[model samples]
Target: MFEQIDCPEAQRLVEAGAQLVDVRGPDEFARGALPGAQNIPVQVMAQQAGQLEEHKPVVLYCASGARSTQAQMLLQQLGFPEVYNLGSIQKYYTC
Candidate 1:
C-alpha cells in the first residue's frame, strides 16, 4: 500500500520540484485546486500521464482520499518514481 504524505511534507516536495497533480474532475478542479497543481483527472490519468516527467516526484490529491490513492498506485505501476498521495484536498487548506 502507498503511504500518504502530510500536507507540510507534500508542500516541501512541491517546492522542491515535485509535480502537483489534482486527480479530480475538471469541474471540481476548476472550482479550486492547490497552488501549482495541474488537473489530470483520475479517469483519464493513464492516457494523460505522459505529460508528467517520469523522473520527477509526483504529489497527488483529490476531493477525497480515494481518487488520489488510486492514481498513486497506478502511476507507480506505470513506472513513475516517487509518487506521494496527499489524500484529500482539504488537507492542503487545513494543514
Candidate 2:
C-alpha cells in the first residue's frame, strides 16, 4: 500500500531527493505548484510514468486527495518502489 504523508514529511522527502509530482491539470499547474514539483496530470500518468526515474522515490499530490490516491495506485501497479500521496497542494502550501 502507498503511504500518505503530511506536508512536513513531504518536504523532508523532497529534500532527500524524492520526485514531487503535481497531478493537476495544465491550467491548475500554470497557476502555481509546489516548488520543484513537475506537472503530470492523473489522466496521463500511466503513459508518462516511464519518464520518472526508477532510482528515486515519487510523491504525488493534486487539488484534493482523490486524484493523487488514484495516481499512487497506478504507480504502485507499475512497480514503483516507493510511492507516497501528499494529498492536496493546499496542505503543503499552507504549512
Candidate 3:
C-alpha cells in the first residue's frame, strides 16, 4: 500500500490544478467533499475511466488512501500517466 498523504500536500496539488476525484461512496461524499472534487466511487473507476478527463492530472481519494491508491494504480495500468492518489478525504474535504 502507498503511504498516506497529508491535507496540506493534497491541497497544494489541488491548488496546482490537479483533477481531484473522490472515490468514497455516495453517502460519504454527499456529507462533504473537497471543493471541486467529483465523486466516482472506486468500485466503478475501472468501468468509468472513460468518463475521466484525459488531459488533466488525475488525483484520487477516499475516506482513507487505500481505495484511491488502488484506483490510481489501476488507472496507471490502463495507461493513465497523470494519475495519483490524494489520500484521505477527511484530510482535504473542507467544502
Candidate 4:
C-alpha cells in the first residue's frame, strides 16, 4: 500500500500533538514505542474504535508496516478522517 506518511514526518507529527497508536500486541508495545503512544493491538482496534475520534489524525505503527496499514484502512473505514502509518517500530528509535 502507498505510504501516507514517512517515519521522519510521523515523528514530527507526534511532537506536534498528533495522536500516536502502537498497533502491536501489548507485550511488544511494552518493550518500547514512541513516547505518548497508546498501545492497542490491531486485532482489537475495531472494537475499541470508541477510543478514537475522527477530527484528530492518528499515526499508527507496529513491528512492520503491514499491521499499521491494516489499522489505517480500518480506521478510515470506521470514519477516521486522517490516519497515518508511521512505518515500523524501528523508526521510533532514531527519532
Candidate 5:
C-alpha cells in the first residue's frame, strides 16, 4: 500500500518545494483544488509523469484518497524517489 502522509508533513513538503499535484479529473480540479496544486489527473499521469521534477518530492491528492493513492504508486514505479499521498484535498485546508 502507498503511504498516506499527514497534513503537517504535506505542508512541510510543500514549504520545502515539493510538487503539489491534484490527481482528480480536469473538471473536478477546475471546480477547486488545494492552493498551489497542479492538475495532472491520474488518467494521464503516466504520460505526463515526465513533467514532474525527479529531484523534488511529490505530494498528490484527490477528492478522496483513492486517486492520489494510484498516483503515488505510479510515481514510485516511475522512479520518483520521494512521492507522498496527501489524500483528499480537504486535508490541505487543515494544514
Candidate 6:
C-alpha cells in the first residue's frame, strides 16, 4: 500500500535523496512548486515511471491530495517499492 507522509517526514525523505515529483499539470507546476520537484502530471506519470530512480523513494504531490493519491496508486501498481503521497504542495509550503 502507498503511504501518506507529512511535510516534515517528506522533507526528511527528500533530504535523504528521495525524488520529489509534482503531479500537477505543466502550467500548475510552472506557476510554483517545491524546490527540486519535477513535473510529471498524473496523466503521464505511468509513461514516465521509468524516469524515476529505482533505488530512491518517490514523493508525489499535486494541487490537492486527489491527484497525488491516484499517482501513488499508479506507481505502486507499476511495482515501485517506495511511493509516498505528500498531498498538496501548498500544504508542504506552509509546513
Leading candidate by lDDT = 1
Give per-residue lDDT, candidate 3, residue 36: 91
The residue-by-residue lDDT of candidate 3 on 27-86, one tens digit each, is 999998877988888898889888887767787888778889888888888878777676
- What pairs collide in candidate 5? none
Deviating ranges (above 4 Å) for candidate 5: none
Which runs in model 3 stand beyond 4 Å of their true positions? 1-5, 93-95
Report the C-alpha lDDT of model 1 over 1-95, residue by residue, as the tens digit: 68888989999999999999999999999999988999999999999999999999999999889999999999999999789999999998877
lDDT of each candidate versus the true structure? 0.94, 0.91, 0.79, 0.84, 0.92, 0.90
- Winner by lDDT between candidate 4 and candidate 2: 2
Clashing pairs in 6: none
**Which ten-residue region of model 6 has the weakest summed lDDT?**
1-10
lDDT of 5 by residue, 10-81 (tens): 999999999999999999989988888899999999999988999899999998899999999999999999
lDDT of residue 94 for candidate 6: 62
Report the C-alpha lDDT of model 4 over 50-70, residue by residue, as the tens digit.
887668879999997899899
Model 2, which residues run further than 4 Å from truth?
A: none
TM-score winner between candidates 3 and 4: 4
Superior candidate under lDDT, 1 versus 5: 1
lDDT of 6 by residue, 32-89 (tens): 9899999999999989988998668999999878999999999888888899999888
Error of 5 at 40 (Å): 0.3
Error of 3 at 4 (Å): 4.6
Q: What is the lDDT of residue 47 in candidate 4?
A: 97
TM-score of each: 0.97, 0.94, 0.82, 0.89, 0.95, 0.94
In model 4, where do residues sit more than 4 Å from their true spots?
none
- Superposed by TM-score, candidate 2 places the C-alpha of residue 71 at a distance from the truth, in angstroms, of 0.4
Superposed Cα deviation of residue 49, candidate 6 (Å): 0.8
Error of 3 at 69 (Å): 1.3
Better of 1 and 6 by TM-score: 1
